[model samples]
Target: MKSTQLTSTVHLDYGLDTLFGRITKSAECQVGLEQVEHDPTRFALRVQPPIPQDLEQAKTVLVKVDGRRLNGIIRHTERLEDQSLKLEVEPE
Candidate 1:
């Protein structure tokens, strides 16, 4: 038996539902965020404080691993359970 890593793009959702924990994300899935900076000199000197991780939105892209270039994958915004959507990859 041979072991190989795969990669590909997955169609997923990071919609509002995820923000409320209504949806789940997968271990393979990753989250994207934007860093915001606040001026302390302002009257309300406050910042969001760099939060390591914040459930924001979901995204799908081509993932390459080992020697596989997978395509047509899907995932969620948050991890509700251990499940992922992958396409049937056939050897050419």
Candidate 2:
């Protein structure tokens, strides 16, 4: 499998609403996507500003990228000095 290094504007869907019991908060930001190893469902995400502080490990989040909505869980997170957030996400 071939891996693509892509950086684009993506939507991050997180948090829950009491009324919907589903995703309620969304933020538009630039993100870098690189496939992890040979797995298409796993990715290393380098998220740029505006960086979100709510994202954490084991949190389920939806990322809308290039017209595809990817539902995945954050496996790990790292805070960069540049204020960008690095994340390892695995699609569930």
Candidate 3:
């Protein structure tokens, strides 16, 4: 499946420095993470398996991410060596 990029932004309770420190630590895990790109306005996350295998768990988890509330459920499958998937983002 081919996937397109969808985007949005969110706010974090933690300070930028602290938040990035924590995220950098978390990125050490080689499960679903692909890359983390930071920009002036927002953070771009490239992840695999765009749709979490468990929809309920994913929905609940995503709802709690940096106060994000996804607008829709989208599956973006990418045609690459890793076959990445980009999912829905909230709080635009």
Candidate 4:
């Protein structure tokens, strides 16, 4: 699908399992949003640091951006050489 790139700040909420128990972590970061022309519910997001590890395996990602709340499932993930994480997400 064709995509248009845009920039925005977002809050990512995810759960992490620690030695104690599962904990929720919230990260605020700048992200590049690639909106898919054919499918508005599917897009690619690129984010930098303060993000959780093993994010692709996360059950669900709660994204708050552009005054909209989205629950996304990570379809794929790639770690760029610049240390940024690229993820293909499908909103549910």
- Compared with the true structure, all predictions reach lDDT values of 0.27, 0.68, 0.29, 0.68
Error of 2 at 10 (Å): 2.7
Q: For model 4, how does the per-residue alpha-carbon lDDT over 6-84 read when each residue is reduced to its tens digit?
A: 3455778865456787666677777766675566778877777655656645545677655667666777777888887
TM-score per model over all chains: 0.22, 0.66, 0.24, 0.64
Kindly list the per-residue Cα lDDT of model 3 for residues 54-77, writing each as its tens digit. 331222112223334423222233
Could you say which candidate leads in TM-score?
2
Per-residue alpha-carbon lDDT of candidate 2 for residues 32-88, written as tens digits (9 for 90 to 100): 666676565687677777776565432666776656677777777778898877777
- What is the Cα root-mean-square deviation between model 3 and the actual structure? 12.9
Residue-level lDDT of model 1, residues 7-88, one tens digit each, is 2322222222444555443333322221122422211101121211432332322333334343222232223233322222
Question: Candidate 4 — which pairs collide?
Answer: none
Better of 1 and 2 by TM-score: 2
Query: How do these models rank on TM-score, best leading?
Result: 2, 4, 3, 1
